[model samples]
Target: MEALLKEAPKVNHHLDHMPNMLVCENLQKVYPTPTGDYVVLDDLQLEIKQSEFVSIIGHSGCGKSTLLTMIAGLNEISGGTIYVDGEPVREAGPDRAVVFQSPSLLPWLTALQNVLIGVKQVFPSASKAEKLEICKYYLDKVGLGNDFHKKATELSQGMQQRVGIARAFALKPKILLLDEPFGMLDSLTRGELQDVLLEIWQKEKITAVAITHDVDESIFLADRVIMMTSGPYAKIGDELVIPFARPRNRKEVLEHPEYYDYRAYLLNFLNH
Candidate 1:
């Protein structure tokens, strides 16, 4: 553990020159209770470099989702500031798109239409055909090529999520926030979409932050895994840099020499 901590700085050395896409400084979340204020996150500081993919993990109710929503500007921040591209995050904007566990697609909308909801907002000036092209391209990328015209109500849960992911990417957001986007999916489907996300992320090069309970999914998708301590007042517990190279193969990652050691460290942190 000591050696790993010492070596952590080397992992992001490649990203050193890039500017920070998201910066959370002295961040906090609190709710005013009748009796007293309830605090969730406190003094949580994080710096995500441009185009970086980071996964955050912790036990339930540890402010994992809270933190994500705060960054999304969907939740109020009690203290500190969050910035994207050095601009303070004040409210939800086109620059950041979120994929929740539930796709929450309107039943009347087709898969393509569901995605166009955000696409139109982000690229209103583009021609109708150009918007359709962008939407269809992402849907196909997520393996929803044939279901473009299908209603959100008609698609399976997994398929609905594909639409959600397609929607997020189609908007061309500079930052993507994923709140357990695959939580409702079965293991097999979840694994497939994880790969799909990686593929899209690779091509788009958007900065992303994902909150997941699955540790393997964390290691497989993230360049670095940030673990949080249990909350009433949660903060960054520790972070581990994934040693595997990008465009990773699942099998290769699972078989890497350091896989189990890294896995053990994450598991140990969660356990304690």
Candidate 2:
């Protein structure tokens, strides 16, 4: 276990001093079972700074999704609190938008309509023309500009996921939660969207927390890779700072001197 835990990397001065955009302190999630109670997470602590991209990785059933949904206000937190921009999270709000494994687009709506539903919710006061431009801008950013009117059902799985990404960003959220957003896509599509996501994040600079199983994806995208301990009482196991500077180049990041070292450390934690 000691060998698996590497020395924490040097923190970036720019991000280190930024105010925390999201804070999770002493978080607890308990599920009542017939046998009694099952504790899923205990005293978990996390803090993400403004515009920081953090990737969460853990062994199967380590409560990664549980933590994420609670932060998004989709699931209840049995104890403790999740704070965004210094306010406690009590319920779901537009300030936080989630992109799940399944894009979950409404099949009957055109791709543009699907995005408009969310945009309208968050920007009720914006003019019709403004809303249309926001949705169209994000859809174009995600590479779906030409297919705006296509029904969700007519789009490929990857295209549907693109719509989901477009919708999430169109809300201009303070924090974004992604629960394996590309988990269902093929490798090719997954990689392409990863770049698209990064480009958008670079421009928006919104704080985001993403749960992923792929180590490579985690490393390539996040400023910090947060590793969680195994459940039935999962907590943060360790945190590793990604050294490559952004806007990150995939080839350069893959060839980075510390890339393999970071990868080995992560794999060690899961394997041991």
Candidate 3:
């Protein structure tokens, strides 16, 4: 394990070089149900650097989704602030694109049309050919080239999720937010999508924040895995650094001596 740690590359290279792309300061979220006020998150603070990929994990109902929504500016913060590139996040904008667990595609629109919507919205000044090229490039990147004309409802769950990913990447947002985007897929399909996501992220170099429950997935994808505690009031419990080199492979990573130690450390943290 010590030898593997020595061999592993530095974990925070992107953070050291890139400017802060997103910052959350003492973030909190409260809900007013019919019964009373409920606190979902408490004093949650996080930072994501430009071109960094961060994965957040915790027990169910740990406010993981709530935190992502708040960062995406889809949900209002109860009391705190989120800044994207030094400016406060006031509402949803093209600068931040999100891919939800359900894919959230418009059933009425074809996959090509769905991607075109994001391209048109983000690059209205560009010519029609430019928009079409962007849409086609992303759809093909996500392994949806042959199905571009298919409607959302006609595609499988995994295919629909691919469209969602392609659309989010097509927008070329300053930050990409994912809320358990692969949680519903089977193991084989999920692994395939993860690889595709990594390829796209490396190509685009976009900042990203992903909320997931899978420990191995987090370790494989993120430079750092931020773990939160279960909530009525959830907060960050630990941050695990993944020192594995880029262009990682699941088989090779598992064979490394440090893999078990790192996995065990996170498992202990989560189980405790």
Name the lDDT value of residue 175 in candidate 3.
Answer: 94
Cα lDDT of candidate 3 equals 0.90
The better-scoring model by lDDT among 1 and 3 is: 1
Residue 45's C-alpha lDDT in candidate 2? 92
TM-score of 3: 0.94
Per-model TM-score versus the true fold: 0.97, 0.96, 0.94
Q: Per-residue lDDT for 1-272 in model 3, tens only?
A: 45544655545864687788999999999999999989999998888888888999999999999999988889989988999999999999879999999999999999999999989999999999999999999999999968999999999999999999999999999999989999999999999999999989989989989999999999988888889999988999877778777877878888977888888777888999
**Residue 112 lDDT, candidate 3, scale 0-100:** 95
List per-prediction Cα lDDT, in the order shown.
Answer: 0.91, 0.91, 0.90
Candidate 1 residue-wise lDDT, 104-172, digit = tens: 888899999999888889888999999989998999999996889999999999999988999889889
Can you tell me which runs of candidate 1 are displaced by over 4 Å? 1-11
Candidate 2 per-residue lDDT over residues 183-207, each given as its tens digit: 9999999999999999999999989
Model 2 bad stretches (over 4 Å)? 1-10
Candidate 2, residue 223: lDDT? 92
Best-first order by TM-score: 1, 2, 3
Clashes of each: 0, 0, 0
- Output the better candidate (1/3) by TM-score: 1
